[model samples]
Target chain A: MSDHKIDTHKIDTHKIDTHKIDKRDWDAHPPYVYPDYKSTTFRGPTKPLVPIAHTLSELTIPAFGHEQIQEFDNDLTINGRVDGEPQGERIQVSGRVLDEYGRPQIGTLVEIWQANAAGRYIHKTDQHDAPIDPNFFGGGRCVTDENGRYTFLSIKPGAYPWGNHHNAWRPNHIHFSLFGMSFASRLVTQMYFPGDPLLALDPIFNATADKIARESLVSKFSQKYSIPNIALGYEFDIVLRGPAATPMEA
Target chain B: MMSNKLKQTPSQTVGPFFSYALTPEQSGYNLKSIASPDMRADDTPGEHINLSGKIYDGNGEIVSDAMIEIWQTDADGNYLDRDTPPMDGTFTGFGRCDCEIKKEFYFNTVKPGPIEEGHAPHINMIVFMRGMLTHAYTRIYFSDESDANEKDAVFKSVPTERRHTIIANRVEEDNIVTYQFDLHMQGDNETVFFDV
Candidate 1:
């Protein structure tokens, strides 16, 4: 057995604020059983979730190193190309990852996957009747720098049809996954393009009841980051859960 | 300085298309996954065991597109910090597995010791799938650790009747130890999910 001692002091510090920790705002998120999203019927849990304290397990997460990410991993336009350049309008997506305290979450990992410009994914499950771009694989990943910022170059994803409703078509969006400082900070969300008319009709996007929270998922078009005649730029910032505020000593 | 105005970025579903990107290996992508089911190296300490389970939806159908990630303390009950080097360089106590192909997820790692007094040895898990808007958080506790589980505060927080939903049954065959723990999203045997 290894002789590593358990850090009792550190464990105690975390236990003190277990009850006083700031709870996540469930009001801002969609309920588990939103009927409009047809799949939720069989997937959403029926029992009330048991609230528990954040133990050592919940406060820690595995660290992802820079070595794991390759040079072309962040450039989807080039990394997945097969024969020639992907046929689509290239765009750049850049943003900063921050905590609730507004502090930069440096060295965090951010991953993105989306349908191709023709609204088709390079997976066996997606049988969308769109032409697959041989050049576009539609996936990329990058680690946050010192300023908690990451960027990816890819084509603008198109809207896709689903069988949710009679004529359900998802809005143009990209799936994003982030690993922040702690397990509580992990987030898997989708970033939607601004000014998509489908935003009003999409059940998944409208799941979040709060108007402001739902709007926050939309990335704003940025001229400063856009390259002339190359790729348009869009900025999407993410805020993770911060450490709970400890009560003052009596 | 903290800003109250800075609300969290709302969550969205991972959708059915995440396999090609997140769990590339399972989906036949040439790229490597950041974390895999193999969490232990050749020399990692403690009793190495395989934890495997299938996730069932409300209809009791297997969730083939779900991704399960687990975080646990090392065998010595030490939660290694990002900066702390382990006794063996490879044991990170983290694992990620996708059920896209096999319809079940499995992880190989050493059984964790208790983190502190009155706590049970357990693995924290998070579930992400295409249908769920947000991920579900759950923990895996050993059925063999009844003494510790009874005393654990977290276990006590769960209703008595529902506490069994979180325990994993242990089975051994030919020197290989495996823990079977299935998760139910709905219906009769729904697993106890926690909000942390």
Candidate 2:
């Protein structure tokens, strides 16, 4: 116990070295520049807000199995009209899991989610005029394959209407969520195609300080299709934090 | 790569446009404090992720009152089993860093263990806010422990390059490990959120 004693204020979870290298040199993705902190003091919560882990974080949207959220291959119950054995795409999304130092680590579990061909999520609230394909639930999941590779078969999501405006619509895209083997590895993001014009207007995509990252989600046109005659395909590479660019404490 | 061109060129927006019966505040989705500073524990000394950063809306605002949690293994290639419910020998390696209303997060934890395959133990983190139903996953491992990391089964699973996402250094100051992990709500440096 004496050997593990830690100084609360002395610990610093930043700066892995006095000579920190540019994260990109060792990293595959763009560098991350952080924002300034408003206040750096630990003040008690008005009334300690206990964790509500049961909500969004705990949701197990059920992987929806190996079929379309709406249309199943030949198994499960198809909720919506099956579009003639939809030959959408089995997009291949791959990327390395880098630490803060831009080093590639392994064993990290990666998860992904997205909307169905109809652009509607199986979620109850966001189901715009669009019908919910009790089956087309894109938000389920898929872990990143070895080699940092992750692949899944699902329809390229379409744009749907939103109440945000007189008639707001989201661009065609899929939502992705990832969790490393431990509680320390967690990430959630949406992957999009290249041609959609909504990238500029999408608030979520715009939130990032890096322009390139926002651009990374879009997939390039690929001639190689796991499907027979799919018109479009999406491939987005996500780079997660590798290691301690700095430390994890004060 | 080409798929990215199509989406950004046209710039289609992705979203949860419809308001849920639960308000954003009630939903715990606002980015209040983006930068949370923390302490790192180490013996010999080294560096770590600052464990800071934020989750922002398109508005570029740090969500206020949001919670962040992370779980991981240790430096010896073993898992942390403090929270397990006492059933098996399996080590349920996990940790938590919950910060309300700041895009940035601060953690005071040690480098996780390495597996037999030489893979360094990594940390898994999750983010929760208003109007969102899923949590993300990302791992952080030691930068200097290459020999141990080389054999980690889970570490080698990802591509060689992507593995960089979990590598961190072991800096020492006052006998404590100092590292920082800044999260990105969006963009290339975005925090790694998984679907698992």
Tens digits of per-residue lDDT, candidate 2, A1-250, equal 1211234333243544422221212112211211111111111111111221121112211121122122222111222234544223344333444433323334334434455566665544463565555444343333333455554555667787654445456677665544432232235556667768876775544544446555666666554533455333334555443222334532
Q: Give model 1's docking category.
A: acceptable
Error of 2 at B91 (Å): 7.0
Q: What's the CA error at residue A79 for candidate 1, in Å? A: 0.7
User: What TM-scores result for chain A when each predicted structure is judged separately against the true chain A?
Assistant: 0.89, 0.56
Q: Name model 2 segments beyond 4 Å from true.
A: A1-105, A180-185, A230-232, A244-250, B1-126, B131-196
Interface CA root-mean-square deviation for model 1: 6.6
Question: Which stretches of model 1 miss by more than 4 angstroms?
Answer: A1-21, A246-250, B1-3, B85-87
Please give the TM-score that candidate 1 achieves against the real structure: 0.93
Q: Score the docking of each candidate (DockQ).
A: 0.46, 0.04
iRMSD per model?
6.6, 15.9
How far is B47's C-alpha from truth in model 2 (Å)?
34
